[model samples]
Target: MEKGIESIFKPYLEPKEVYKGGKNIPASTKKIYKLSSNENPLGQSPKATEALIKAAQNIALYPDQTDIRLREALVLDFDHKLAADQFITGNSGSEIIDMILRAFINEGDEVIFSNPCFLPYSVFSRWYGAKQIDVRLKDFDYSLDVEGILNAITERTKIIFLTGPNNPTGTYIPKAVLEDFLARIPKNILVVYDEVYRQFADAEDYVTALPYVMQGYNIVGLNSFSKTYGLAGQRIGYCYTTAKIANYIRQIHKPFLLPITSIEAAIGALNDKEFIANTVKTVQDGKIFLADAFASLGIKYWPTQANFFIIDPPLPEMEFTDFLMAQGVMVRPVSQFGAPGKVRISIGDQEANEALVQALVKIKTR
Candidate 1:
């Protein structure tokens, strides 16, 4: 123990034995299609790979600190008020989140968010000595309860994080409802709109957090190249905030955190409009396939606008997930997402989805 470091360390979340599903599957079960995390099953963008290889040629040099190309690419594609001054790149969406909580929250300040969201929001909040406030979703649809969230705020509230086409449940908040909530909330509080899965949305009512940025709600919109562009391995994600705040964050950001190759590849992925359009189509088809299978199995599922949906398990989720692993399929058990009886399954490719459905049926019949 370092002297001053020991007193500053605050722990609120215990590290669970995270099931990085099926790391040790038997050889017979080795053919398993991992649909555990909401990853792009179709794999990385072809263009991203090409760019990455070209970038690998420059490995001898230190990565560029500014990461110019990707920042300009993001600027041209998005219509928000953000300039290059307003963006701060990180290794991933989680890294941007960790930066925000540490930079903005002081000890004892309250952080509010919907329950069962990405676990890191609460975990990171507590790590900063801030209070964690969870407002329960109304039902399995995982629709946000605006009144519930608004009531949770007080003078102590420092941040409110809301995910659109949210994780685990694949549900979204409607524009009118979101507008109403945003309008009513106290102006001082910062609302972080995490839009990692926004690209997978099939609904006509979907709202990107960009407009909120334009309106200057003291909001920060977190976007990722991970899901749609299949740049997960490159770990590129960032936030759009007011220019002043972004400059403030840069003071604490690790120098050269964004690798030059990731910037080039991410830039390349953005211009691969055809590949992105195709990825969206594939993900939509997958959502339909999973929905149909759930209906046929007599299992209930939330109506999803994202490429995944949450299912109410007939058996306990952890046990059911273990059973699926034995049959050479993998899924996320939502026990860790604070819904012990339900599990989330990412919509994979056609053959993989079919295999999952078959394995699920066999498990139920037994």
Candidate 2:
């Protein structure tokens, strides 16, 4: 018999724990508040819902392989004077990250990113046989040490992943710091900026890297319809870079990129500016409410620019998570992100937020 498989696939033989959404509570539970995933509590846009319903009739037809309409809509949405050729659509933002890795990384190359930014950056880098250089966050505030990142870079560094309003910690990169880092890095290295949570960020200093791409810098900005548009189930994501890099990703892109329904939904979502504004407002309000609640309970939380925040819970993270789960409230334990004592909570609607606070209070008292 032949050997089982290539040695490169050995690390993946054991499945890793992936990101998960909130779970359905047991039947005996009276009420369930799903605050695990950082999803729009108000749900998907009404316009997108209507579009999806209408597009359902044409399910048998193949989607636009080139994603022309979707790309055009995105161009208009960004208002960045971008050509449609500068974009590449994917099933999700996660897939776009994968595409970027596959397009640039070779065995023995190095991928550098913060220690706890996004899990996929590390996972995908290892899968591609690239060495992962993880720079630890400065202090416990989850601030990115740009100097540390610059120091970690070497000739073998092919890519660096930066996530704004980074996952779990909700920290962000200021525009000035980003520009300084870019200026120091070699042009041969490509920087992937994951801005999936950009819409939720209210920070004045946070800016998209599209300008860098337009300036012919080696940077790609990855975005998604999942968060602000509440189209997570639709699985639509896109990236913008220089025409050369965009064409490279497209070459690796399989034909029939996204489902027809997803295309229609993204278009509808893009057209509904009022809906997107309302979603942002809702998240902003929820974040304030949660912050106040956490403070009342004497909990320490990292200041957040994104829709979620990490709290140093009174109990162990898993224990706290279990306590909340038993009360029909689900939140994420940050152990997977390397912070065993902290828990990450997604900002939910009024009712869900209240339920989470009450649950925490109950746990603290008991």
Best-performing candidate as measured by lDDT: 2
Number of colliding residue pairs in model 2: 0
TM-score of each model, paired residue for residue: 0.92, 0.95
CA lDDT, every model vs. true structure: 0.81, 0.86
Off by over 4 Å in 2: 1-29
The positional error of residue 110 in candidate 1, measured at the CA in angstroms, is 0.5
lDDT of 1 by residue, 117-194 (tens): 778888778777788899977774678989998888999998999988887778888888888888998988888898
Question: Which segments of model 1 are wrong by more than 4 Å?
Answer: 1-29, 79-82
Residue 256 miss distance in model 1 (angstroms): 0.9
